[model samples]
Target: MSTFEDLAELHIAAEKLLMVPAADEWLLRGSDRRLDEAKFRKVMVDLLSAVNRSVGITGFVELVRQVEATADPVTGKVSPAAGAVVLLALEQRIDDSVLEERISPIMVVLSRAALRSMNAERELIGLEPLAVLQKAVIPNEEILFREMFPELAVSVDGYMVTAVGSHAQAITPVLVNAANPASPMAIGPLQRQLRSQVADLTVKRATMIARTETARVYGETAKETQRTNGITRSRLATAGDPCPICMEEAARGFLSIDELKPIPLHPNCRCDWIPDVENWLPPMPEVVQA
Candidate 1:
């Protein structure tokens, strides 16, 4: 079995190989070719399609098929035969929530990491630890360093894709700004700036995915630990001089287990709601107001 670090490294490697170089190549040489919003989006669709295909959701998709398959009420088993699948849907029931449980490749890796952290916290408090993901995919939004998004995008074909980290909104400006990007791209400021923006966008999206999983798991785990006579309050800890908003959030001091989540944590925000259990994780630099 692949460890969390292994999967994470694979994701990073895939991005570096598949997304960044191709995007930069296009930006440097192709952005000027009758550039327009629609065209740029098309380019994005192509790039993201390639990336998704490369990373693959093979394992996850297979799992989804098994979990979503209608189980026979009598035997409590499912057959792989096509006839059995048809009969299950027509005869047995299908779970609508099953589709939602399907996790992305990157998410599976990140969520596993979150479980590790959550267990670490539980171990500190002498409580039983969790081992499964019982939630939707979410990124660690509080991370300060990332190697990559605008937001989720749905193309005209009803397909949503992540273009490395570029978004529909950013495409317009990139369409305008990417003209005449420096050749021998490594030497040009605008080329670097454009590439940097994409990297920043990707980082935001990736962080959000990782943070969402980590925060949700941590918050829920914190609540669970509290049931075992653990700490009831949480402190909004920060690295240092956080932006105004985080400064304000920090002022709120201790919050209940229910109120412990500070998610949708602003970009550049390094604050995490630590269980006020003493000796929690160290504070991170607060996010500057966006």
Candidate 2:
């Protein structure tokens, strides 16, 4: 049985193993060359592969075990079996929409950061940033997932294809506004910007994924327990951080099961939802005998 802290550490480790390296590799490639569509596609593919390999069904299963082992703070009871089912359902949701729900946004953010780094490089060199005429088309998710997790891929090649052309379209204006193509550009600032963006986005995306998945699994587990055991209320438990908002919310105490919501009060929120099975039923009103 793992503690909540143990579960957190596992998530952090997975992020470092998968997310950080992928982001760093992308930034490295982006910094090494001028914006080229071919290279960018290659890097994106590599990133997707890395992400897929880093955390698989096995990793998620371990997470489910950890979450189940940890006792609900309010009730001090662990519901491993129920939690397992909920986690599996969450996995299904991830499989159905991971590309659209998770990867695409991450790619867009990475692309934006790359463009910004290029512009910053141009500015440092006294040259205006180049206006982006067209954006790299984001590759098909099925294709990306095929080599790694073929079973998880919905189709081999043909499926609903969505391109990240809009992400490129949106960022071009920002680059055009900041760039001065007429002047000479330096390489140092651009390199620095790429590194910084990579580090920042890596942590941001990883934390978002971890926290979001955790919240989903926990919420589903709580709901399952409610349905199974007739439990009707839960409470929010924090990592005991000094964050004022979390503390204030924690002070508010237990809420009805229907009223309870997922954690992540903000980005990187480490709070957990603890089902209060023991005290779930509300007190009966006394009869008025006049």
Candidate 3:
């Protein structure tokens, strides 16, 4: 359990110490992957060339064909590009497990502090301190990854399409210039596109997952501790620039312990829970829900 002030502090620390930094790391790692732009461009070009005999035929005909793969409805042929993207992204992908590992350091510190908080509260209330902190179990990631890879492929395939269309417009000479390792043309825009999309979409998804999981950990841990001590209510604190939905949730002061976890109204929510403390909050002015 935490005071509202304590919850605010936790929320701030998680953002500064965990989410933004992790996003930057993921963006950079997922984009260049430690390779220089020229080298990375060459690598992608080579992969494309291998797939479709050469960059010329590949970028123009092959990419268009793949995009229009289901054009023949009766036969219903699968998109080859989709299949390729799935395999490539899977071969070098970061799923929930990787994200968990990335955020675990901060999570561990936060969870320990929470455990201590629960213990202190119990002692104050003349109850026994918890013997052990409950550990959150890692689910079967292989099955999860199997479900996720195709979704990632959908995005990566789009990025490939972007590379084909941007700057070069799938023309042979321009693409060949891009394929050249020294003084590459058209690759810079493609590289920027890859980095931009991954940073914007993938990083956002990862950040959402991170925050949601962290809130789950907080909620579950607090729920158990509160149940043990016969406490029944909690509060959610809004941090950063919150949406109207969040304002509404926050306005419902000292809600039931069941909703103790931060339930994000949308992705990248910055709301967090205070511990199961009763009637401590003054009434908040209600906001009209949309």
lDDT of 2 by residue, 1-290 (tens): 11222222223322321221124444555533333333434444444344334444344334444444353544533455544454444434334343444444333333343344334433432345455502323444223323322321322111112212111122222222223334322545533543454444334443332344333433453355354455566677776463887788778798877776665676566665565645345335469999
Residue 118 C-alpha lDDT in model 3:
43
The root-mean-square deviation over C-alpha atoms between each candidate and the true structure, in angstroms, is 20.8, 26.5, 15.4
lDDT against the true structure, per candidate, is 0.38, 0.40, 0.41
Model 2 has an lDDT value of: 0.40
Instruction: Indicate the worst ten consecutive residues by lDDT in candidate 2.
Output: 156-165
Question: lDDT per residue, candidate 1, 185-250, as tens digits?
Answer: 232564456456555655544322223332333334456656445466777776455788777787
Q: Which structure is stronger by TM-score: 2 or 3?
A: 3
Count the clashes in each prediction: 19, 12, 0
- Cα displacement (Å) at residue 65, model 2: 53
Ranking, lDDT, top scorer first: 3, 2, 1
| Reference-based TM-score, model 1 | 0.38
Task: Choose 1 or 2, whichever is better by lDDT.
Answer: 2
Q: Which is the winner by TM-score between candidate 1 and candidate 2?
A: 1
**For model 3, how does the per-residue alpha-carbon lDDT over 3-49 read when each residue is reduced to its tens digit?**
21222233332332222112444453343222222333343433333
Q: What TM-score, over all chains together, does every model reach?
A: 0.38, 0.33, 0.38
Residue 122, candidate 1: alpha-carbon lDDT: 49
